[model samples]
Target: MGTSAERTGLPDTEGISALPADVPAWRVLLSYVRPHRGALLAGGVLSLATAASGLVLPLVVRELIDNLGSDGPVAELVAAMAALVLINAAIGALGSYVLHRTAESVVLEARHHLIGRLLRLRLSAVERHEPGDLMSRVTADTTLLRVVTTDSLVGGVTSVLALAATVVMMGLMDLTLLGVTLLALAVAVVVIGLVVPRIHRAARHAQESVGVMGAALERMFGAFRTVKASGAEDREGDRLRGAASEAWRASVRAGKWEAVAGNTGGLAVQAAFIAVLSVGGARVASSAIEVGTLVAFLLYVYYLMPPVNQLASAVTQYQVGAAAVARIQEAEALPIEQLGPLPRATDQPIPSPPPRLQPTGTTSAPAAVTFDRVSFRYDPELPVVHDEISFAIPPGGMTAFVGPSGAGKTTVFSLIERFYEPDTGHVLLDGIDVQAWSLTDLRAAIGYVEQDAPVLSGTLRENLVFGAPGATAEEVERALRTTRLSAMINALPDGLDTTVGHRGMKLSGGERQRVAIARALLRRPRLLLLDEATSQLDAVNEAALRDTIAEAARTTTVLVVAHRLSTVTLAHRIILMDAGQVRAIGTHRELVTNSPLYAELAATQFLATAG
Candidate 1:
């Protein structure tokens, strides 16, 4: 969030730059206010009433001064003064209430629309922009917008009207003095014009700096454990401090410009006051204007200062608001993953189907998933991650992908999940192109458990039902038991209700993996993609997890990216990959005999055990 200093920086400026001629930022902002048009109109009316009431005070002063020699009642004077104060207070309160309520509603609606758009954005788009930058747009930028929506809009209108009314009243008193006042104000307006753009530029930079700082902080905190282990606390602190300092410097620059603008406006008003006094005093002495009229004119002149100052401040506020709007618009403009109108099947139970194995070379129709000569690269300038890869997972069976590190093993899972589109060829599900199916429908049919098994900050029950929101208690228990997590759940202090702590940090590695598997099982997907949990575990835990995998394979089509040789040995068939290509395909024993890379990996592990 922007600091209090940054928020107030613009109100102190002298002149602001003209808005861009090409695109109307203010028009775009006003669209959000359209929904609350009634409240805005009410506020504007109240502001006009307040300005009119304020105008009455100078008139009352003029009357009092003019009729001093007349037989005017002292009681009437007191009553008039009292009425003026009461009217001002009542109108002020009404304007305040209306402006505040409307501003809150505008902010609420903006946040809702921004969040909805963000959620719909494609995974690729989200990956392109840092999460912390996105968060700043929603949280910090919206706060800056509130200033314009409430104070700037209401105060600006009232200020302009009051200034106009005061000027006309001054003209009525004495045109010569009014002309002098106008000259001084014109100079002030020109000076303010020069300053407003500087303030806006500074404000935009300050906002950008804030987003940079947020991204830096998120990166540091996200890899907290890694930083600690690497003993890089001081280094991380320095990086964060640098980001914060940059934000501070940008804020200070913006504040400095605002201060100059505000002081310049004040100087202009003071000059106008001095000019009015000198010229109006001469006119009074010459018998051209009455002393009472001159006195009232001076009072109106003083009142004009606040409105002029407010008008300048409003321009500054607008610049800050515009900076925030730009950031928000950028997020809203991102292309989201297309989700078609597929009927939600949350209420329906997933039917368990018997597992059936089909041969790899069988002339039967393709199964649910087929990678037909697919090739993908995250960066166009870089070599492909998966090159001309063709494979098929039949409707039901256990097929595993095994390879050395950086052999495109995980890329296969990424492709299957549609995290990235293949540059060449295509991926098909049930004869339909993967891209043709809506992302939601395609993902709903497949359950994926990543290697790290991320857990959110919530109770165990919340984590279990995350994948399947409407899963029954009985189904939850069945999933837990199927993954061998029921015994551990019963042993925890709060059982299913136990808080997972941030990212499930409270659970052991094996426990976390089982919890993830249970969550996936709750979805009861036809195809399950398991990136085998490779965290080192005790022999007992390993044996139990192997048994759990075997049991799960009985019902679902299991495609696993295997890291451990022992895990790969259990596969009915293993596809060996290397350097973005599927090098060989066979059972483990056959691979050891036919493929040199497979034999080398097995031998390396064998020798390590023997030693």
Candidate 2:
């Protein structure tokens, strides 16, 4: 398979991920914070004010100690210290709330942007990555932005500045004690610098393992019935266990490195305190500094703990968050469809039972389709599915494509829908190249039903109107009747409101096919492409739907890929195909008489006399 970039016409690098390898992690983090700078600034200021108050408390203690013998009363100084502590608490609380609120807003905006991009991704891009892996980027990876934006960025700046101010205060008290403090901290700084980079590598691996585990779970659930029927419960369970264990082991590695970096700060502070205590005692005895000054100096060492710990924590968080940011960037780099302008979301109350959407198609005339020498392959390494094949269908009536499997039958519908572009040549609608047409306008003109006839998990009524949300109640009723589904729906307790289980498992194969056809019919499309649409229906239903399809072909262009003789006989023209090219095109009698492949197929199915 081709990489997402190769398949989607995006810029490709040597590796699988499209993450801008040269962009710094900090720059990506700042982009999320730029919109909320005002709030972040206010919070940073309040935090600095809180730190200032704490720094002042140690000075007041020194004055109170120095004046103890001469003061008539020490009550005033004690009360002043108490008031400063209270003010510090209040400011710290307010600042914390502001930063947290801003962090949440950043996360909300990130999710909105990611979701919009993911939904608009080209089909080729979606196919290249697992659904579960993409989902992890939106949910797990985006959550990390909260801490990176606030605690890592804003908190980091505040911690560094407070550390600087505390160091200046200590220097004025005693240079000897400040020297001892810096020596003890230097060892920790070296150790942390060596350890921080490891955290980033470990964290990225852990997150990737988590995505893998999610993909494993999605695969099992997607084919839940097959697993159960095959009696592979223990086998599948073991696969899930293996993935979970890998994620756990990777997480433990990241946590171990984080723990080392975090505790190194506290250890360094304790060592500084012990050294300051021993050195200050000697100075006091030698009359180099007074007891009061030694006491204040000790208080400053204790105060250093908070800022030092904060800096360590900020670094550790950044290492982890940067990994997540890289994953998010990789997801955002995928190619997205160029859907035209869309309406913005708003907070205004929408009326219950919302207004219907207007159909984009202007006329009821069937659309003309032409494939001009189209040659395509899904990947460069794969063989061509269409080898300069050319075919055209006029404005109306039914056409059927018949061939052995792998003759590029389904590729025709894929080309028309522009799901994947051809390597060479043009696919035109109404004589206009599809590439030149607006995606919305081109797709809006047609309705497509795939080979599987899949239905989403929803109520029966919801599935019926999915293609045409604005379809009226009468239109829905008419579609149900035309598909011969009205009686079955009426027999159910909820009628149209009855729920269809996941993938419509509650309905039979034929019923699901009918529901799909009804959905396409409600769109009132100019072109209807059905790939083996009636393959699953019973003989009675099949005959009824053949008549329905014939009726639809009068005003709509209907294309079917058929294998059964019953359905093939209904087509106005049959195109016989083999390998990657069109071999013959004619009515049933003309094909049987002129094309040996068609005659052999008809004889094998005992349809020679019928034709």
Candidate 3:
């Protein structure tokens, strides 16, 4: 849960390392390449052959030039030169194709591992990061690996082979000229080394700034309606624009450093080319070297230019990709949730067992739910949300928790559903410690409907079966009838097949609530937890909703966290809370007389004066 800054691998321009930190970037890059090494090695060998063939082309041309009018067959020399040219072009194309395909395969591998880890990450880990920023890592960051594997890594490799071959050949032709060439290139190397780290820093800053911008945009979109209604569009726009400007500035800075490095490399290689020619020309004039050999050495000098320039470009591209890989590494560093008895992440997928619900049985069993001195806080630094508070709801009855906002009423349901764990005390369900039960089984045994009563973007049938994937058609009809949704479904043009828009925005609040209710009922859960399920409904729908809760309680336990007291006045038992403590627990009529806080809430929130 520490900051990403503490672990992000962006301090240097080196590639991402999947191994331990001591192993270094080269080894890390090799690990990703190792999977596709066969293809990469073939491509690299072919690329080396292409460079070698290119060197031979100049030799063929030099031979043609020296033997133009000689007794030697000129037609055969021209044919040989033509063949080398075609061979160079063909090998270059084939090598590039193989490397490019390998890069794509690497990207797929990285994404699959990243996504699997992301989906299995603990809820707490997910909560600490922004959805949009994480999405940027999954998508934008993964794309950068392609350039790293293909252009930067492979290109650097082939450039080294070409540079080494060219240097060796140049040395053999004229050692003195090669020495001068090396001295000139050394100045460029010093200049490049000085700026490489700066380029890395700039690129990392740019990528991080872009991630911040993405997070800002996600925040704006998530609360778009609120922003418009509050007339805060200008404020929000300025905030997003500020984040964008930061990214732009960092990118421009990175580009400036990259340009400096590229120009330095180009100028150095060009200077070396000129120096080699000047030295070789003088040597040739004094009969120290042959004219044909000088021409071939110059061809080697030209060949040296591309590898040097390519190495420079590759280094710059590598810094950019390294920046992206750093971001991806930060995301992958988090621990994934232990899905079951066995971990979910592996080279081969593990088959997950079906959720086993606790069987509903004899009425003489312990209470369906119990909280023993529970204490919780969303953040350790913040005030406690639940303070050593405890309560129990027996089976087969509607129990309502009526309280003001921030009283931790809704938190109780969250604890039971285990969206989070209590920091200090135990939460039990049907006499079993919840910590001892399987997360899948514990959740499968309870059905939860949030305050918003979220409906997914899918067909009615899909939503109905979401909680209970294996629910039967008869089960669906039974839930619909109980939730009083059968009438609504019959009126729709597509009935159960009707498409619900995003977050079920296509349906009214009442309809969405009913859909959530039906979905929960279809699961045949032993306990139903409803958090302000009727808070947004009109009087008629609220009344219907209360009746529906009552109907559901006939066979199962119903726990209600009520915002409006009238919705749960008829509950078998009422627990009144204030701040994070239960103030009173009894029948509504009993609490009305005993608890002053409950009475105040009834007068101010539950009962407004007659219209």
**Per-candidate TM vs. native?**
0.88, 0.90, 0.86
lDDT of 3 by residue, 1-611 (tens): 52232256322122223444344444555666776789888888988899999877777766776776466668998889889899999999999899898898777667766776687777778899998898878787878788888768888989988999889888887899889888988998899899999998998898888888889988987767789999999999999999999999999999999999899888997898888889889998999987877888778778888888888888988888878777777887765655353232122332232234333422222138888888999888988989998887788888999888899999898888767778887787775666666677667778889888988889999999998897768778977887778898999999999999867867888889888988877766678888887766777767777787887788778888876767657789998877888888998889889889888887887775210
- Which residue segments of model 2 deviate by more than 4 Å? 1-22, 340-363, 605-611
lDDT of 2 by residue, 1-611 (tens): 74344476543322122236457788877776777789999999999999999999999998899789667457888999999999999999999999999888777667766776788798889989988889888888889888877668988999999999999999999999999999988998998999999999999998898888888888898888999999998999999999999999999999999899989999999999999999999999999999988999899999899889889889988998999988888888888876542123122332122112346433377888898999999889999899998888998899999888899999999989888788888887777666666677777878898999999999999999998888889889988989999999999999999999988989999999999999998887888999988888988888888998899899789999988888888899988878889999999999999999988987774364233
For every model shown, the clashing-pair count is 13, 0, 0
CA RMSD of all predictions:
7.6, 7.5, 6.5
How does candidate 1 fare on TM-score?
0.88
Candidates ranked, most accurate by TM-score first: 2, 1, 3
Write the number of the candidate with greater TM-score, choosing between 1 and 3. 1
Give me the displacement of residue 376 in model 2, in angstroms. 0.3
Compute the lDDT of residue 49 as modeled in candidate 3: 90
- Candidates' C-alpha lDDT: 0.77, 0.85, 0.79
Candidate 2, clashing residue pairs? none
What order do you get sorting by lDDT, best first?
2, 3, 1
